[model samples]
Target chain A: MEAQGVDVVVLCGENNVAYATGHAAPSQEPARAGATRTVAILTRTDVRLLTPPPLDFDDGVRELAAAIGDHAGTLAIDEYPSMLVHAALAPHAPVDARPLLTAAKFVKMPAELDAMRRAQRINEQAMDDVLPALRPGIRDTDLSALFFRRIFELGATGNTVDPIWNVLPTSLADGPFTFTGHLPFPLPAVGRVLEKGDVIFNDAGIDFNGWASDFGRTWYVGVDPDARQRSQFRRYLEIVEACRAIIKPGASAWDVAIAAREANGGQPPWFPHLYVAHGIGTDSAELPFCGTDLGAEIESQVIFEPGTVLVLEPVVWDDGHGGYRAEEVIVVTDGGCELLTDYPHAPYE
Target chain B: MSKERVLDEMGRREVDVLILGREGNARAVSGAHRLFLAGERAFSPGCVVVAETGAVHVLSVTDFGVPADAHLYPPSWNPATLVGRVAALPGVRSAKRVGVDGITPLFEALLTAAVPDASLVDGEAIMRAARRIKSPDEVDHLRAAAAVARSTMAVALNGVARGLDDSGVVALAMEAMAAEGTTTAAFEPRISRAGQRVTVAVGVLRDGWEADVTRTAPEVDRPAELVAAIARCHPGVAVADVGADVHGVGCGYEALPADERLEPGMVLSVSVAGAGDTVLVTEDAPEVL
Candidate 1:
């Protein structure tokens, strides 16, 4: 903050608040999250949190003003509660704190990495309980039930995404029409019954001590993958290896994105609306986004520093047949990168 | 029916356009089942409602649960790009008043730059006014959500009986809720054990409506203060008199003004501190769901 000449920093996003103040409440839907939101304020010398009662009843403007206590310096905030727009922060012309926060969260410390690893371990172990039941005639929500139960039992703090067990159609035309003309993925689970030859794209996440874990895989129902499905998985693995080969301490996100594209025959092997890879920490998807619509200029600027954690998810779509997809978590190191995800590509391998 | 109500409210409030970032507000207006993500998303125009055309434009990449005629815009990581997309919506350029449920400094600046003539106001108030009174079908959805919550609470109680720890009991309850086909929880279960008594607060969202309840294991008697507060849940009763913990329950934990009078069709979740129940205000009596 001193380096940027920012005197006061206010954080309103739940994960950002947790990052700044070490205070956490139960994870919730957006509406409830707004009603029960907390704010953390940090000055050059002190950090304070305005929580509950006063913040709720008074709309947080008065409470935030009181917490700041007359520092009359440049203010920066990740989000602005509009009630405070003119009342509390307009005078300071609060600037966007996202860039500074993003830079700070770009690389993980040893403790944050350990917490993320623990989170992923719990996620994988819970999936261990969920996969055995992935037979024909099971509802999508049934898998979610088992995974949710096991994660909490394994000491997970929160469930991040709503456990996607999306069944893919054979071709792009058979699926819902997407604006990008590419494959649509990761639709929310709606209790659809599994059929004999369904191809399931699984994605879910959980949190352990404020760190997030993302788990994704492609599963075959009731039988082993056919020849074409195995080939798709091989292509997916090749794309992942191509990206992994260039992920080093000083590599730009563009390098990794280009490697994946070249391996996939010069086409982006990821969802159009989504990314080939994303960074994860307190927030499920944070900085170091690779191959997103944020534009190529920004992607080139996001350089990988040592201790940067990335979730590389490459989708290998065979237009006539169903596709293959999975997520691999890796941490960039001085020597190269180390894999954090330890799940198997069972049906394909 | 809900969209008509929103349109009516928009006319009454004299707001020409609504750019909603809150999921509950977006779901209420668009009737689209977008993906459920936990925590606060950075402010962006997730849904846009135009008064002139009565059209709902949702920020969705695919037409999964979206209405066929609704305008769709793909997701962008850049706020400037999103602002440009929203600006291209019909009747947005000439809108005199634009309401937003939430805003950030960057978003507000971008919106102002995009539509320089429109005045930004509190769209959240308009949404609350439209959603405060639940229709019969909305009430039915709320009742269904309440049943799921209560069933999950029962599973948590069962875990407490088996001497499981707090997280273990939460696990059992969450599993039970998902088994009932409700995968999204309203919030993480707040369970803590002190001595022989355990307090369990569980909430769930089925479709879009919400049901939240708090209870104690081993069945402790309801406190007199809570009972008195719940008794005031009747038509024409001021919400402040009802209690601070009492909040309107519908798509989300709807916020009602403390000075506002309780209406007959409104549903309320009264949590006096921690233990409470959801009730329906009627012409004569309040029925507990």
Candidate 2:
């Protein structure tokens, strides 16, 4: 943005807030009561931290003041406003801070890459315990509850997102009868049960040390999957692997996306249109979005440098059938890209 | 059982011999029992405990990392060298590699690796039936959360003004909540600008509307008459209809025409406009909690 002659940049989005300040209320849950909301003002040589009133008047402000003092200037602020108001006021700073930082975070730093890898390891462990617990009579909500309980017990704060529980039914009507259907439901109920031959899909993430690792896995309940279903699973895994294979330094996000599409028989999943890939860090979604029209190449000639973290997911869906997609976290490096998630992409038995 | 009876039933199902595993079953039962078990390490992916009578044997893959002694584990030599060890003490049995779902192919793998002869039982019915009603402690926490939300609204109303936008109101409310030590707002509050005047017909309109139309009759000197006029207006009447009838009346001309009904528990923002000036009235004078 500085090269483009833009002087100031203000960030108000939840993810942007996390990038600016270490403190961010989890997107999946409400903020703990009395936690301080923060706004950071970044200039060429100085950084100022602004906090909301009452919270700032208390000990939180003093702690923030001390933390920010090492950066440059004394913290200066107006009244701490809502996230929206803060975004509006963000650009008023002397220099644009968002574009600069966003470009920098496109590749993962070594520490961030390590965090993602650790998070994925924990996720795999949780899956090891969770997949077997799924049974014919288990309710979708009950399964989610178990996932939450186990993940938290394993030392994770919580799941990165609301665990998506989809139960394959004998017919489309039977499938849509679930509580949440498709409209993104919140909370869980105990009465919805799993039936025989149900193909259960769990699309969830794990938060380790404030970093997130998300992936999706499918399970066949009560009976073994059929030949066609098995083949579909293989194709899904192949698509994800194809994307990972070509994802290296000097590659474009579009190229990675296209590789996954081509591997899936030229018909990519709905996920590509929904969200192909994005940078991930403290906040779940970061910068450097991968889509058809992004135009930006992934080479060194581009602004994004090494040490940036990214999530690559290619989705495939059929209108009459259902949805299948696989996701993995990767870090841009000097040599190529490093895969953070090491779990096998095949369906859990 | 009725929805309220679920927790009681679960409490009754707790066994004296508890097994700590690395899975949800152990966590749920432990949380339900509130008993701290000592010494039992998470043996493998699955943990098991058998009661003295052997009537109830709980199998789970979730690990809580409780002590080894609180719950018994399988005994094995060279605990240090064991990649995955199964220990069976005097009264307890532990499994090293149990799958999460006891019915899947992985479950078979877990059973073969640990106790292949263990019987499969359905526990979902028992567990789901237990978490329905909110316990007293849960209720208390929810009430506390609601109070925080209400107080946050109070702060927003106090800070609202004509020039202030929606974002300003939201900030003020959040700031108040933060000051009060509440971490976040339960929901976003609604704020919008007041509209211009309109007309209303009698009979079709409510008593509050008639009272509003006639508000000019009451004055500071005539307290009784003002009270009488107020009495004529029903507490449940809609604020908009009332404002419409009194649009040209003394202070009524300045009233912002609002369409919301006055409910007993409602937190209202009562405003009146006159001579290009505005006045706001709130019940109990909303304050930052």
Candidate 3:
């Protein structure tokens, strides 16, 4: 705040509120989520929160204005409610707080890292129960059912996304058409039943007290991998290893992006719309995003600090045959990055 | 028919174009099955509805059951890029008034700069009016969603009877809902245990519509408060007279004002405090689903 010369900072987005206040709320659809937002106000000296039961646009703006009191300094805000803009904030022209937030949240503290580790442990253990139940007759939603039940039982605040257990086609031509022509992935699960040899790309995320755990791996139903599939998995590991080799404190995001592309023969190994590695904290995807549309210019400027975490996901596409995809959660250290994702890459492994 | 209804509302409100930011509004407008990501997001243009051409352009990477005529654009992180796409839509740049469900400072600037002549107005009220009356297909989807909610709800009630903890009961209920092919939940199943009484509520979203059901342990007759609320759900009665907490249960939890009148084809989820079932209001009577 001092660096930006802003006296008051207001946040309305849920993840930003959670990050500011250390409070977690039940996740809902967008409309309900907006209507039931929890607003947080941070001044250099004090912090205040306006939770639900009184959070419509008009009342929220009034409370926010009241909280600001007589401060005449500049205000930074994460979201703009039109009512707020038309009423109290039209004069201030609130500066965007995302850059300030990104800088502050880029490096995780020890306690935040511990929270993430616990969240990942819950996610992985739930998968341990889910993986054994994957078979030919089980539908995609059946896996989702088991996964949801296990996560709540094991203690998750909420499920982050509809658990994706997408059954990928052998060729991109057979998959859903995309404007980018890159293979679309992580589509919502339906009642599609698994076949004996179908390859499944699994991805799920859950919230544990405002911390997010992102899990991704590839699975096969009722069959061992063929030689081509095994080769795909091996190649995926090679790309991951290449990225991991240079993920030390001083390394730039561009260096990791370059290593993954070079390991995959100069082609970006992840989805074009997505990233090679994204930092995850309160939000499932956050700062230090590498290999996204932002490209090399922005990426080279993103330096990895000691406590920065990255989820490295690289897909090894064999085109005619199915491919292998997995993600590793690693935290940068003084020496190198340490793996936070411990789920085994079995069947493929 | 849904699009026609929305267009009619737009004509009534004199909105030249609509830029829907909420996922439910976008889904309601476009009839697209986009990926469901949980939690609140900052407002950005997700779907654009051009009044002049009646074209719905969605921000999607792939056409996941999107209508054939609807255009798809890959998601962008840059606000300028998004504004540019919205500007290029057939009628957006020439529009005199652009209605948006929500906006942020950055998008407001970008959009204003891109379309210099357009005035950004509140489309939320227009959407609420358009969405108040459910179409026949929307009713069917909501009915199916209610059935899906009941499938898991029974398991939850059973768990409450079986001496399970709140987490255990909720876990079983969610699993059952998913097994029925509904992975998205409209609301987290709220289960609270207070001495002898255990209140369990579960809601699910199937095909972008919502249905919510709630029950308590030691199942008894419907509470008088809720019964009175249901009885008052006639075509012209004001919702405030219902004497309970009533909310519209459709694409999402539609938070209507107390004075809003109940109309035929409006589906509502009513609870005194927290024991409610979804009710469909019609000209003759209220049907509980």
Candidate 4:
């Protein structure tokens, strides 16, 4: 929000609320699905949090209030009882802090950056363990279980999201696509054994310490690759490499995306492409997305800032085959960007 | 023997033999020793006991198929075949099935088919009572799982910064965990914005269980003052009192205590929210595992 020049940020997302106020509650009712009605007000001189009764009435809130009281005056809140803030400040004059308090949290600080880094490290470890277990004859459900177990064993509080396993046969007509694109579905069974020539794609990520990391990779299950598969894989890799090549401190997101599109010769009926890359840090998806059509310029954009983290994915679809996508996480540095993933770009048998 | 003295009087009972089912029952009866028919069935539900002098016999009804040498048939199956088989077994005195409520209906049928005159026993409470104490191995697993959770938090904290979206942050965190060899997250990561505050929820499962542990870091402006207030939150003070004096709380985890007293053993996740910044504190040192 600070980077975007927006003040008095009003966040409705659960994770965002948690990030700003340090208090998050599980959705008590169904209507609150995908919504957590917690609010944090940050002003230059004071910070206030306004939340539903479920979250405010806790010892943690007491502790938070004490922490905030040391810093500023004139506690301002929306729904919280004004009396509570006033009573908390006995000797001091009660100041209404609504507008000014809401404007302060738009900027990012160093300590928040440190916390996010720790979250990323935990996520990377989960991916490392999951990649090797991708083989034939393993049930997707079992794989999911293994993934959960591994993440726990590795010391994460729990997964922030569901593990996704997609196995596609070399013959695209056979149809290995099984995801329903819904939540809470059971893991797929490993009923069919992996054949000698098959391509398996696994898209997975983890949530650690209230932060999240998501990445995708496609692997060759067996030794042989036909000409089409090889060509497709090569093109995908080329685009990924090209995307990374021009990602510098000053490069525009538009130019970076156009380079990828041009590399594909402006193929007709352009593959259903999402953003080439998105900012990642405290939340899983940030702003300043890399795409051709967005009116926002890439220069000095929020997404391209130094110290920003991003996920870069290049995708392509073949009529005979389903689709192929490869993604990686990169942290924008002063000079360029550093790739955080170790999944090999070369074909593996 | 008194009910409480059952373990002390194990050998004093008149019954010569004892039979138990698989898994839970097998463990209760033998304490880590494998039963004779361990490998025969997918789910174990059969136990047979042969008595001596003035003897007692025990049988389990969960058995689907058994050798001809066995004297009991599950009650639900045909009684005639069970009687004929029991009568044919050598030195079989009185054959009976152990009847227990809460047993699956299918097992009850098998027991009824095998033994017509079996004694029913209510052992559900006894079985449950036996499992309350944690074994040495169980404790070790719990501690190990907690350690794993702590370390994963470290990895997550490393990549967090301003401007990253929820999905991007979660993906990076997961990548860090994967790099450390974890294949899954414990729970769904919650990342969103609520009225100017950015929130991140790190949910990780530990030791085959999901702990809905959450941490919230509210973005704030005055870091120095927030830090001063947190520094004052020592043992034996009301957190609410502290908040009354401080301007705001930084970002971290929130716990609602049942009482006003803060004890040493109790774990509390503390968040100090400031403008654009948040800090997390816990009884455990702030370092990622």
Candidate 5:
């Protein structure tokens, strides 16, 4: 904000407000909600958060405008509460600061990184605990619930993103894969029962104290070695290698994405494209998203910088079988990228 | 909805076309009428334009196959792109006054530049009034959603043990809801082991309707005064003035203002609005739908 010459920033988005003030505004729970504009205004000298009674929201908002007087300069805001924020800061426009804040938060502080590491421990524990229980007849949602509950047990404040269960049928045949979207939705367990020899290829981002840990593993349901299974799993390792090879401080977001796709023998992505790499800190999905058009990024070409915590999720797939996506969180360092979460993809390594 | 009623309201406000983009308003309007507008599921600042003749044209993200009759932008399209798309829709070009539910600052700029001649008025109150009462089908969806939640809580609580942590209990509850055919749980369930305090919120999406409810632990019941104050909220009374504890529970988990009144069959999530121990507005007392 200081670099952008933003005189006073009024944090309206819940996540941004939480990031700025360490105070989470009253959320509507799984929805962008709150009646009164309990906003945080950051001036050159002081910071103010005016929370109004739900009844006196209009009057409270009127006061918000008065607080943001004169030095309107460049106010940054998120899109959800853009209407109310705009109404309150009328005349003084709020540029969408999501991109700005997202970029700024890319370099985690030592304490922030420590918190992220602690968050990954739950995911590590869940991966270890759930595998032994994996077998035929387990519903996808149940498995999701089991893992998610494990994370909660590990002390996750709340999950910014939901646990994804893209469990495939035993037969590796042509069909729609149940991969979760980029949106932070925790898909309640669905009733699709797993069959013998089925592969549970899942990905999830757990919000541990607002820090997201993205990691997942692929497992064969109560089965032994098979040529087809081994070959499919090999492709995932290749993509991971491709991402790691170029994930240095100076790497380009687009180059890493193209590399991962090409690593799968030049196959077009199932969803047109995949965000092979994304920064996660305050919000589950943050800036420096590689492999896709990062709209409104301050930088024309997003160069990787040291301290950038990236979730390198390179998905590799084969024909007639479901895609194998392994999300390994990494931090870009002065020399190379460090693996933050190394939850294994295969039984071997 | 009575198209004539909406058209009448639009005429009174001198609005040729009422453009609604806010999710809450869009869902409320769509729930009232069975015609689900794809634009309602769109990005903020996107819209469903209700024409003066009662025809609805939508502009939303492309992932959702917007009806062949409506407009669709790429899933990656932002609000500014949507504002332009909404203005170019068939009816909007000819319309004189366009009423919008709400506008972001960036959106306000993009809109003013795009439709210099058009008069844009905030039409939230008008649309709210139009879609105030829940239709029978909407009521059915809400009922199914509520029923699914009740059964889910039953199954979850059945599996709970003294040693189960917050996450484990939540998992059991979610597993039950998932088994019962629920896809969305409007909000994350709140669980704490100290007093076994749990606020299990279930918002199920069935037949394109989202019915929401929250269930707290049996031990921690809400104050009787708070519950009574919430019950007093009716179609004309502002809910906020009733009491500081008053909250909206069903559909969207938002807090209503002093002016936003509760209508009959509006599934509210006021501390387990549709859950056990909740009352439905009646001449006598509460009854399950």
Candidate 6:
């Protein structure tokens, strides 16, 4: 921070807090109105954290200003500032430090990489324990229940608060259903029953300790996948493999996307900005995104270095075949990429 | 009461448009209160653009989403693409002044470039003020969620085991909710182990309504002083801060302070660890629902 001429850095996001501070600092969940919100400050010499008084302040803004005092060269996380924090600190012209922070975070510390490896291990083991229990008539929620139970058994405190757990059939994969989301439907993992030939396309995520794991997979239920299912599924898995083969230290983030797009049969996806691959660690979707959606200039500017963990998920969306997206977490290695997640890419239990 | 409060508060703030910004970070997967007001549920980042007159618009980005109505963008809107859509919002595009639920330098820059002349102000107070009141449907959802939470807690803590870790206890509650037939556990089920300060904050969603309740396992019995401090709570009664954990749980988990005066139909989870039963404020007394 001093080298960058940045003075005090205010850490608000949980992951940022965890990155700067060893443990995940408890920040108030921002789901409510007028609840006590916490913010932490990191300076050259000292670190201070502040929270709204527990029902004490009539003018919380005034108190927050006093707490902030007169720090001029301030830097705050753009993604997690509160209204008061923005209003009060805007005048000081705090440096938009997200880019700087993201850059610093891209090259993970050895411990950070180890933490991610730990998180993915628990995530993969949980999937392993629950896959064999799959049947034709099981409800989506039943799968979620067992899958999550296994995660806990393997040592995750809990999954990320809004992790996606969609369990739908291949018939509904295309236009009608979203394969990735926390609450894609009115209810998550309930009432929806799976039948034979259904595809369990999951983009579920979980948090172990403060680190997070995000990956996607598609599994066929009781029957062997038909030709249409096999083709669509193969398209996505092949793209992931193709992208995986190209990733290495010193690869351009944009070239990674363009080459992956070419390997993905040279056509644009139904939607835009859906990266063929993107970096992931604390945040599921971080910088270094590559795909046809990011345009050529942006793709050319993205470069990957050693220690950066990225999720390569090539999606195939056929209106008739529905949709299929399988994600794999790989770390940029000196020679090539190392697969961190050991979950199966094949559509099977 | 549904959206009129938003308009009224915006009117009071003299803001022509109110845009509720995204909550959490890229990895944080929760909706802001704006989504609740707009009657939309999206896990990804989105914004609710509100007019001075309470007209609400939702723009979301999801993998394969089709909102029942045509409200969702056909190509769905991600954060990168949302700025253009937000700039195009009828109320926002026409506004001379705008109020945002929250702000950041990056978002402020986007807003400034989008609406050059519009002055931006904080709309957190206005949004929070409007969120305090619960509609009939909201109350029912809270009740249903509370009932499930109460049962789940009972089952999990019935014979509390020392071997259970944080995730294991949460798994028990998730299984319990599933067995009871509610798919959405409003928030992710949380369980801190016994020695690490056992706490439970469950946000369960039914239909579109959410009920949130948090409780910490009793460590040492709070002496009579702490118990007596809470005995005075009732409907239409002002509450001085007694310092024990107190918060109101409603449409978006918690939207009211614990020390505020209780209103009828308002449900609160109050205790040091959020373990206190939810109390529904009524015309006369605060009923422990």
Alpha-carbon RMSD, each predicted model: 1.7, 26.5, 1.7, 22.0, 5.6, 5.0
- A104-207: candidate 1 lDDT, tens digit per residue: 89999998899999999999999988999999999999999999999999999999899999999888988998988876677998889999899988999998
Error of 5 at B272 (Å): 11
Q: If scored against the real structure, what TM-score would every candidate get?
A: 0.97, 0.47, 0.97, 0.43, 0.79, 0.85
Highest DockQ: which candidate? Answer: 1
Candidate 1: where is the Cα deviation over 4 Å? A52-59, A84-86, B220-227
Kindly report which residue pairs in candidate 1 clash with one another.
Answer: none
> What TM-scores does chain A show, candidate by candidate in order?
0.96, 0.73, 0.96, 0.66, 0.84, 0.84
Native-referenced Cα lDDT, model 4: 0.43
Clashing pairs for predicted structure model 5, backbone only: A141-A189, A162-A186, B249-B268, B249-B269, B249-B270, B250-B267, B250-B268, B250-B269
lDDT value, residue B34 of candidate 4: 18
Q: What local lDDT score does residue A154 receive in model 3, on the 0 to 100 scale? A: 97
| DockQ scores of the candidates | 0.71, 0.01, 0.68, 0.01, 0.24, 0.33
Candidate 1 chain A: worst-modelled 10 consecutive residues by lDDT: A52-61
Locate the minimum summed-lDDT window of 10 residues in model 6 chain A: A179-188
Q: Judged by TM-score relative to the true structure, which candidate is superior, 1 or 2?
A: 1
- The CAPRI quality class of candidate 2 comes to incorrect
lDDT of 3 by residue, B1-289 (tens): 3678788889988899999888888888888888898888878899888889988899988986688878887787667887898898888998888888767777888989999998888777777788888977889999999999887888988888888888888789889988899999997789876778888888899988999987777753477777878888898888778887788977887877767899999999888755888999998989988
Find the 10 residues in a row with the least total lDDT in model 2 chain A.
Answer: A178-187
User: Can you give the lDDT of residue B28 in candidate 6?
Assistant: 15
DockQ of 4: 0.01
The reply for model 4, stretches above 4 Å from the true place, is A1-12, A21-38, A49-51, A54-118, A169-196, A222-227, A268-273, A292-303, A321-323, A346-349, B1-289
Q: What overall lDDT, based on C-alpha atoms, would model 5 receive against the true structure?
A: 0.57
For every model in order, what is the number of clashing pairs? 0, 44, 0, 161, 8, 14
For residue A284, model 4's alpha carbon misses the true position, in angstroms, by 1.8
Give lDDT tens digits, candidate 2, residues A35-114: 22345555444445555432212244344434434433222232221222322323333232444565655656667677
Enumerate residue pairs that collide in model 3: none
